[model samples]
Target: MRSIGLILLLCTSLDSYKILIYNSKYGHSHSNFLGSIADALVDAGHDVTSLIPVMNPKLKDGTENSKIIRIEPDQQVLDSYAKEKENYNYFELNSFNPLIAIFMGPKFPKKFEYVCRKVLDEPGLIDRLKAEHFDVYISENFDVCGTALAHAIAPKTMIGSYSSALTGQHFSEFGVPEAISYRPAAYMTSLDVHSMVDRAWNFYASLHHKYCFWFLRLSINRLMKERFGEEYPSVAEQSANVAYVLTNSEPLIEFAAPTMARVINVPGIGAKTPKPLDEYWSEVMTRRDQTILLSFGSVVKSIQLHPAVKAAIVKTISRFPSITFIWKYEEPDDEFAKEAAAKLPNLVLTKWMPQLDILAHPRLYVFITHGGMGSTQETALRGVPGIFVPIFGDQMKNAGMMEYNGFGKVFDKNNLGDADKLTATIKEVLENKKYRENAQRISKMLAKKPFSSKEQLVKYVEFAAEFGASAALRPQSVDMSFVTYHNLDVILASAACIFIFVYLICKMCSRTAVKLVALISGKTKNE
Candidate 1:
């Protein structure tokens, strides 16, 4: 219930630091994440500026707050993006190819590289940013260019942020813990590790990430050397200075894993408290005892969903006549959507819906989602059970996380069109009391957690400002050789010591027996 406005009033005694948040225009969730940080810092009476490098020519910041600097993508960047977009339909597949998630579609990294080059080459961009004299710099660690830019500015305190759970990806560069024994890798298909085989796969997945991140540093260091003098620091060296990482993952929902004080788990950081509903949705909620909202989010178009899947969803909705369904279909005007809406009065198709408010509705029963981190966190915080059909990225693992947390079920994307199974899954989540109970319990825990996410952000930024990327917070484990970090050297040394001790003992015993046998033989001869 605490408003940012109220927080602003109480900020009179606080010292305001000039902070810059580097944002990418390519991703909706990523932009929304950076926007939330900017707004939060501004609310805390800090001087915050969002420096957005627009990668997608078509995409722009829909909502505006003051102090935003946007560099539009140039023609070359636009052309590259269009070429990349051709292969970007990776998400529109029936079944998720888990292997591709591990490598990450090559096009994105290429496109990001091109975009970063253009942004860096922008006239006066670096000088303009440096002129701000920012004390703090915050950026998502996914793009090393952002970190490189932060290094050029050389803020007193730098912070890295993640929009999704820390998937043990790039933890090496970020200096966060990535022990794979219990932790799930970013691209791992599931959060639940039951067997040694599962643990082994998680370890390999985590290692793959670490290797890729290491290579990325090499790649970016070359770029840094070219841009600045060859004396410029490597990506790893620059990131080593980051004070802390504000992660979006809620710790309570996660399985047991090693974490560092440097990694701040700010659950529901960007999630907004639900606003009051208007007359239409207000009336609609009252019409049914149970209501469900189905959305695949902005990036994944529901219209593009397979015909069979849509049919299965429509069939599932028909069976639940008593439970009203709200579908956020992009093309509500599509013939299939129109026909379905006409046939089923309980099923409503809308191009846009007040998603947060709908989830907060009193009669809200369940949510059907793509398991995007934003949706996953929002649904969890609102105490809504869900059926997740993850198509790509960490979504598959995110779906597993939700199910593991006990508030949801992961419906395989390939089987989404199966009416019997789809209906059964929905009915199970809807009718089962356990799912709702778990959701409510977790939601209450998040709401009443020791620190408000807003407070964590404000307090941490101030802490960093005071101490300036305190190395005391970092573990000595960072930058250790692979053998040393795993203590394999120690293990090998101990094994060798045991072998030598055993060998010496056997040798002494053998010599003693030989001397005794010789003495016995001589005594027998004399007799």
Candidate 2:
């Protein structure tokens, strides 16, 4: 009996895995996605080690089996980031311009390289990671350094990538079919309806995405060669070896694009279960006759808004004295923002607020958001309508999708200075019953999936860990040349064959005509 018990314990121990999650991005949404996955793994009796940027706040709570390592940025990188934020202009581009955004994509690899360098500079960090013998490595797909670190630390481990959305080009590299004609790019604000003009733009955007990703991979490869020697695999190669990809988008919100079997859509992984509001916030929500939560997400704070725009928002909110507005202003100490908040009796400003909790509140009427994916998904999950004022990145796309789904209304950020337009739009959405009803319908649809996002995520992750890489799942198209994969060669050959056949027929007809003419001349001579 003792021997059998010991064997059962050993089997259980063998089933547990050591997992490594690398997310170096500074954004809270990115960290939250990774943190949620780590938490899930820990709950499933697996050991998790997360390497995240120090700039992001720590995860809420960690179990004893889970460990977090904060990778600090280089001093120069920190200074540059601060300076960039200080001089940042939110309205420089009219909207999310694909050309400009594609050009900017390559710049991220340099920052990622800097972070990797900083990690390597830490004493004994590499050696310690090597000793851990992680069974699997999950990396943020946006940053190349994560994959590079995975290769350097645990070469034999199963690798997977997590993305906040379906990056069409990245998936294309793995031979995933792209629905560029009808599906809009993540950075594009267009809807899924494909008019000729829309298709043209989509084609252009797809090409631009391809170029951007190629450049990014080249940049990372050069950095890897410079640092880790010439034998190191390129970022593209590393990505090709990945066993699975987890995307934080669903077909209901994302355009209906066909994805590979290995690509898992876990749309609401960042969405936390709505907890009861804290005492102070609960009282605040109850005291107000109606409440609106306005947040621009973590990266873009309300205090960073242009002075004119800020004034206009304040003036607009002041018009509706019956409704309370809770703004998540990152710099609550700023005198200008403070003065603006004080202008309206119903306005409340705080450096931070429980956004998800507030969205779940019974009295919360609407959410005024920047249309970030995390915010969009959370609001959709909570069955809340929104007023989206998208600024940059995928926000414009998310806004368009939200409006198309009838869950929200989008107002251009450039029009924020027009108080009348902004105020009227807000009032229109607030007064409309269809928006709330639509949001509720979407929430129901989102909840109708067979398995929850967390459940699917854990199941696939464990599957990948148990069975190494899923090479057989990869399509043969991945190994084919671009021209061959598209069948351009076959098309050109068929065209050539038709041309040759037509030439031969024309030559025979000409010869026959010459013979007839010669015969007629001979008959005339005889006469």
| Tens-digit per-residue lDDT, 1-527, candidate 2 | 99999998898789888898886656666767777778888888887888765532233322234687877667767766776678876655543366565566677556566676777777888789888887788887666667766677873455555546666446655567777777777656765463787777767766766666665567767877887899998766677777887778767876666778878878877677889999999988987778999888766766666788888988899999899899888777688776876677788889888888999898888999988889999889888999988887678778888888888798888888899998898888889999999998988988887788889888888888888677777777766777997899999999999999999999999999999999999999999
TM-scores of all predicted structures:
0.90, 0.90
TM-score for candidate 2, please give it: 0.90
Q: Candidate 1 vs. truth: CA RMSD? A: 4.2
Query: Per-residue CA lDDT of candidate 1, range 483-508, in tens?
Result: 99789999999999999999999999
Measured over all alpha carbons after superposition, the RMSD of each candidate to the real structure, in angstroms, is 4.2, 3.0
